[model samples]
Target: MKKWLLNILQCIQDIYQILKEIKALYNQFTIVTAHLQTIIRLIENYNHLAEEREKTVDTDQHQREIKLLDIGQVMKILNISESTYYRWVENGELQPRKKGKRHYYYLFDLQDQIAKCKLKGRL
Candidate 1:
């Protein structure tokens, strides 16, 4: 019957539409995955560079000295914001000591850290 033939054609059209949609989604997924992979590679390269920079300047282990640095002072010295500094502290990226209900960074180790972070921005 004509009705049955029309119904079958509609089903085929619907299937084709679904297939096209799925292919579009697959392409989008590939693009997103490629972007993520590129970002990961860039992060890995930065980490490698940072590690190399840290290792290149060999310092003796016996010359240990401690120094205290304030938030604003450290921010100015490192050219980073208070939020970023605190984030680094929270993530254990930067080691901070709490004293008298305040957080402080060690000045002795900071010179090296500042160089490592490549301190950016106006803060």
Candidate 2:
């Protein structure tokens, strides 16, 4: 009977060890699941921001195309003098269309030129 009791006690100890191991594994799984949820949230946020930026770019491009300006307005926007504007025009750096003796400039063209200059560190 003593021998049987010792065997039974050993069996219970084995079962206890297994239960502890299972609890540890469950804790690790919970931590990993939380980390995965955080990663998913970050990815979703990034995607949302990207979509917004794309929409803004499209809207900005459409607005620039629809807007038009004259030489004086262009000069004001560029913050340059009349002489400088004529100099650029003379140098063929800018081309304005003359409609019935009135020169007109496209806002989109000027914006593109400015963006290029900025990329080249000239503006």
lDDT of each: 0.77, 0.84
Candidate 1 residues 48-69, lDDT tens each? 9988877654342222334567
Worst 10 residues of 1 by lDDT: 57-66
Residue-by-residue lDDT tens digits, candidate 2, 1-56:
69999999999999999999999999999999999999999999999999999998
- Model 1: CA > 4 A from native: 59-123
| TM-scores, all models, native as reference | 0.46, 0.53
- Cα lDDT, model 2, residue 32: 100
Q: State the local distance difference test value for candidate 1.
A: 0.77
